[model samples]
Target: MSTASDYLSRLISFDSVSRNSNEPVSDCVAAWLQELNFEVERTTYVDPRGVRKCNLLARRDPIAAQEQTLASGTGGLAYFCHTDTVTADRWTGPGGNPFHAVFENGRIYGRGACDMKGSLAAMLDAAQSISLADQMRPLWIVCTADEEVGFEGAQYLVDHSAAFRDLASLDPVSIIGEPTRLSVIHAHKGIVGMRIRSQGKAAHSSTDMGINANVAMVPMLQTLLEIDEQCRTDETLRNDAFDPPTLTWNFGVSDEMKTVNIVPDHCTAWASMRTMPGVDGREIVERVRRRAEELGLSFDLYSGGDPMHTDRDAPFVKELCELAEPYIGANEPHAVCYATDGCVLGELNRRIVCGPGGIAQAHTSDEFIEIEQLENGVRFYQDAIRHWCC
Candidate 1:
């Protein structure tokens, strides 16, 4: 009997931060789906910090023949959402707790209210409204963990889940519930995070016997700047759909000796790149690697995800656009600069990023979602489910 707002309030109450366990939220979602007669599957994995995170896959298959259907290549539609939110230490809302969902001024204020939990609530309500007898195919509701950190939960599902394996064979269609303001998103930039390190001999600063690793890092930093400049000015890498239409880099963190008097033997710079689709991330890394070699420094490519782009002309894209036009009006499909689990899910199936709320409201100090947008999202998902599932 819980409404979408009630469900969202419950979801936001859980502190499913990227660094913490998402099991609490996952458990709540599973219980809700069970009430709706869904056969839920929970996948648990231990993170690097040994916290147990979970991914929930709930399906509405009354006849219990989804496995065969999926194996035969007619996979059902899936609504994908991430359960984790970014950690917030600077909350300015009334309750002074990011986990406390506050309803005020026609908006819901809380952590994850706009970033994702809003869409999760809408999806749950939409599924609840669907009649099992009207369903022509299986319907899946997926909640993943660690999406704010990386696509860890999605990756785990892809690697280990039998349901995912079956769906991959069928090439299922997925709707990723990211905060896209109800606009259809068919493309997004990828991410590459790396660390550049320089090593040298350590000694007293006053003595001429030591080499400063910080000094050695200067040329490498310059190289990174030059590479960034090239990416910015290069027309070939530009995609007009994106706002900036060029690769962007952030050299955000640097580590060196604590004391000014001691000669630093090692310096490390942590940086990341946002790459356009069709551009080779490896080539970009190699460009930096070659420069590091020229400067006689060692580097490590830590982690990365490929860019995602579904063709706007795809059948599913057209159908979704048509289905959403009446509710959200006619908004052309677009690209975003931010990354999502769609970057990973797109590899297995046709994926579109569309949901309630705006990216501007996400992860902010006073994160909130307009109540109207939340209600519209619920209606849109209900109609979408009817269109795709029934």
Candidate 2:
């Protein structure tokens, strides 16, 4: 019988960096669920070399035996949590290894410990504590891979599953257990991360035959600045739930093609757009594309994670609010600028992002989750199951 803290520590110890396969952690979760009498489903996504990465789903039905008593109209709930964390970089410190789980000063320090795996542990602990014989609706626990790189695992699950075909009729509600500091999040902005490449002929610096990629980037930067301003000032697009009303854009990565004496032949800039709820992401991309064409630049754009929202007054939201009351004090429904796996699940059911740790602690150096919060999360999940699923 592993406690939530014990499970979280074990989970954090596995080096499931987003760039690396999460097979180790995913396999451990599969085995644990199988031991709990769940019928586990493992969906594998193979790399070119034939190495397999996976997303695990476990299903349990208390109503299976009570079929005559429960009837066909009974519905269920789904829980989603990610199994990957970002790559530990220079910011993670000299001695920092994101895979190492250290418990000190009432907190557990590690990479995924706070960003997500903590919530996964809490969900598992809660499920194990409750007796399936008393539950009314079925329970689906899904541990998805590749959430950090992109939500590929979740996308595969939703696109390839017949179980999710009639999701609205089956599990009408979904809880994506992100680190929300116990708040119930009903809405969040969308994001599209893309790269734009600029090409020019190479020439000696003395000969002005080559175009400087850095110089070519000026107009694109200016256009993005204009778009950012519009995102800030648009009244209808603004929402108070987020700190700054509208969306924001930033150039996250950039690289110039060459050395000091050579005029570079090409330059590439990677940019990301955080779109507001009412704004159309495709429209924004098109506007950028138009600007790039006018500037005689060739660009490549990739888009994903569209804006999503669930009704604030839905039964699931209400249930979450009631459960979070004692711990977080009358939780207020709100929106966030950061994106989560909820966008995909939103298409299936009414999805809400809620959990124990604060987003501030996520993806930070010496990242840690308070032990008290982890304990509270276990109880919160247990109560949610008892009140709603049972």
Candidate 3:
């Protein structure tokens, strides 16, 4: 098998779901990079549920070896990919088993195949063609954990990784390989999720002593709808760069009472929206929070991050766009609705979300990456490595 296919098959075999320990995947990646003589560093942390998550960073820095610092968008090139896959309980791909990766009809079927083990495989295969002696600058490969969850791995690395800090110093071009279909991405939306709760005394449904907290969410839901509509119509609140050009707001409330006869005391509703780069996410959030407080509801922010925006006209973007011409052919750097680790690694000056495969295939019951895209991805990454590292 080709190195990319071999590495991809091996990677997909590991059930590195976000909720489980990623040590096995990390171990294999570390070993593979080490075989290429790259300096490997690991940052390990336990998630809230005590799952052992590990982030791996490997780099080949010829200048640093001689007591100097060098960096790549290809300063030195750093390819960031997440090791965690979403829960594959719904997987019904050609393999029948999510972890066994089935190859047929010029496609590889499995969990994380397109949503990004394929991209990681491409990076691994591409790196093999470039040795340390072939680089005047540096090359970086970062396999992070918990990206599918909340970018916790990238955030943890930002807070605890020394090597990451050094990479930031170069202001290197950072590419988050996030199923962008190999297009150069200069911007994307961010996530804003929160839970709102209301408290009331419980009593019999027929008795007045019981308070139905569910009634409190009526007005709050109204406020959210208003914001959603305004976002949809208000040019000032929307960015034309996005497809929907709105926050894409969503929320729901679940009834906790087992029986309708008993008065329900607890009610919780969650509303999540996206943040645009040029828009003020704070004001939008404040509007919802204010309504929740006025209605005597408890509001808590669980997930929130600013949209990533890198100048499309930047030299680094231009170079990538030019290089991607063979694939996308003069298509301007695009934007996506999804969020990525770039939300956490915002400090890196030139950041883009570019990778193989389509988001259309991700998180589906049957996830796969086309063999042609995978092979082209290998060539793309290899050329990028040469551009930034050599």
Candidate 4:
């Protein structure tokens, strides 16, 4: 079997930036899996704007396209990992070109090296080694696209004809291979994208006849801060596994009035809220809207994902933790503040997040994955597949 570290080096060299199409990387992975005797099914996805992307679903033998058989008593398993990475910005030092693979100081440096191409490579290489082995439940590996955008790739695959109605393991135990530093992730926060518009009367600043939209933003920001604080102190809602257990609100993009002399008629701000499980994101949004209406400021709060979690003591969770102890050392499973493809995949299966690399290294310059982490990841996944599938 090819070592995951060597496979990762090649994945780092592919340059599958989120802005750039992932067809090349997807094609490369499809070719490798097929060579290992996997039957590949490619799903073509078109964005609302007509942009097309690809999702590859590869499976092993003794299963037909219309087969619905799953290993009885012990179900099937799905391995998911995204091939796309965020655009590498111009940075000084080793990150000048994130596409160029660099292996030094016991780490691998590249654009998608840690944010997840490394995990993808490790999963792919490991899957290839065991694709055709006789097993109880079939193994399914999904290679998705547009994860950097909105998880379009994974979402499409789950709802696609092949995943829901046709595949053998209809509701497999889904594992998202993100950079979790080899931690077993049973729960994480969910995101809600929102936009609020503050309205005002337009007039010359000198005339003092205009309602300043900029002035209106102050109270909105304050209210958001208050909400954030509430999220921090709410005891019943907090999960100690997470450092802070509550909804986190952060500003996104905003549209402001330009000239200081003119009081603009509209001031728009985009914000997002990441909520913990059991928090009613939609209700919070309605409350924000009510507050805006009471203040007489035109505002809109659109609700997003409330947050999702899996019982830490679930059988699958227990089995996975047991499988990883030998490979990853005393495993400490926990929840995180970030979101992953697990949110969407949860709809189809019992899902968990586990992989190599620290979350701190993701989305940063000089992003990398430790060589030891990759090796451990390889072993953990191998064991999981054997324990569950074989």
lDDT of each: 0.83, 0.78, 0.87, 0.74
* Candidate RMSDs in order: 2.2, 2.5, 2.2, 3.4
Instruction: Give the TM-score comparing model 1 with the true structure, all chains together.
Output: 0.93
- Per-residue lDDT of model 4, residues 194-253, tens digit only: 677777889987897888765676677777777667666766546556656666667643
Candidate 2 clashing pairs? none
Leading candidate by lDDT: 3
Q: What is the lDDT of residue 197 in candidate 2?
A: 72
Query: Any runs in candidate 3 off by more than 4 Å, and if so which?
Result: 63-65, 68-74, 203-209
The alpha-carbon lDDT assigned to residue 48 of candidate 4 equals 64
Stretch of 10 with least lDDT, candidate 3: 65-74
Worst 10 residues of 2 by lDDT: 88-97
* Candidate achieving higher lDDT, 1 or 3: 3
List candidate 4 stretches off by more than 4 Å: 48-50, 62-74, 92-95, 166-169, 199-219, 256-265, 292-306
Candidate 1 segments whose C-alpha is farther than 4 A from its true place: 64-72, 200-204, 207-211, 256-259, 294-296
* Better-scoring candidate (TM-score), 3 or 4: 3
Q: Candidate 1, overall lDDT? A: 0.83
Each candidate structure's count of clashing pairs: 0, 0, 7, 0
Q: Give the lowest summed-lDDT range of ten residues in model 1.
A: 62-71
Clashing pairs in 1: none
lDDT of 1 by residue, 203-273 (tens): 99899999888887888888777777778887876777788877777774365467878888888876788
